[model samples]
Target: MSNTASLKKEYAERIVPALKSQFHYSSSMQVPVLKKIVINQGMGIAVADKKLIEIAINEITAITGQKAVATISRKDISNFKLRKKMPIGVMVTLRHEKMYEFLERLVRVALPRIRDFKGIESRFDGRGSYTLGIQEQIIFPEINIDSIT
Candidate 1:
């Protein structure tokens, strides 16, 4: 089995029981689990150059191993010169195996490469969700540096 599958199995067998015992939970379903990972990038400058959106799409695809879908503006804004249905951003939603694999790489590899890194903050909303923001896409080892623009 792949590393991610085995890691998931280990979590189910070891972590789940510990969590249940610690939290006084009755069912295993009460344990928190990673649901999905969403990567998003706004293409505001794409308004000036349409090719920027395509480049953003390619970069997102290379990072996530999935095609990104364009996000459209819902309302027209005269001040920003925005129109309805304009391609404003790109995003990829990763779930299941892909999500786990990405999480594994993010935790084990990419995060450590950040200069002067201490540790991730242990903050979360009331809901069982966490969000992390990355400043540069180059941190991930998967992307070929020569190809990036």
Candidate 2:
């Protein structure tokens, strides 16, 4: 894919050199690169209908092209009717090629489709990692609108 090829070229020709110059690093390996893309969805309704977790898992899989694993509660909360080991969310971690592909789709396709869209915030964590939250999965072209419920 052109996106994949261009991203690779950008990293090699642009990013690696920029990092090396900025950080005064001697080896190309010292430059940081995107390691993974994590897609997560919290299934609060799973407490009422366990099947909801499966739907979230399927949605995440469609968006990321990877199967999602359930995230269980780490502790019990009596008032909230939560228990340890209860599946409360689904997450997929995309590495290597999949991570780059998903990013290309997100930046080139999905983000532009939103109404009244401004550019994304340029905020990052101290560690240089960024997180983006999408309001709906239908914004992704891979998902068929008619199939959404």
Candidate 3:
């Protein structure tokens, strides 16, 4: 949904060299690289309105240019009346070019669109993985703003 530019180019052209020197890496190959990007959304409202999942899947597919799949519940929950295999969420895992392309749009466009956004907090899981939560999908320009209610 962005220009033809890619995050991979920026990483190789600028970030890689900077990190290579900052960490004193003997070779560029030693630098750690991203393998994939996982975008997920939990739709609790789906419990009452099954059509919401289909709409979400359409929006996510439009944004990521990939098919989104529903995530099913593993077990039943009595209080919420949740049943096993109920579609409770949606997720899409992007790899290679799509991952980098999404990252490019996320960094260059979506994040900046947040109102009053100063910066992002950096938190990496113990395994060198990171996670970030964005409350609204409207930040993405690819989604049709009018379609969301």
Best by TM-score: 3
Q: Which run of 10 residues does model 1 get worst, by summed lDDT?
A: 43-52
Each candidate's number of clashing pairs is: 0, 0, 0
For candidate 1, the lDDT comes to 0.86
Q: Which is superior by TM-score, 2 or 3?
A: 3
What overall lDDT goes with each candidate model?
Answer: 0.86, 0.88, 0.89
Q: How close is candidate 2 to the true structure, as a TM-score?
A: 0.87
All-Cα superposition RMSD per candidate: 1.5, 2.0, 1.9
Measured by TM-score, how close is model 3 to the native structure? 0.93
- Tens-place lDDT per residue, model 2, 5-63, is 88888889998999899999999998878888888898877988898888888888888
Q: Give all TM-scores, in the order shown.
A: 0.90, 0.87, 0.93
Cα error of candidate 3 at position 25, Å: 1.6
Candidate 1: clashing pairs of residues: none
- Give the clash total for candidate 2: 0
lDDT of 3 by residue, 1-149 (tens): 34535456677899999999999999999998998899999998798889999998998998898999999999999788899999999999999878877887888899999999988988888998888999999999998789897
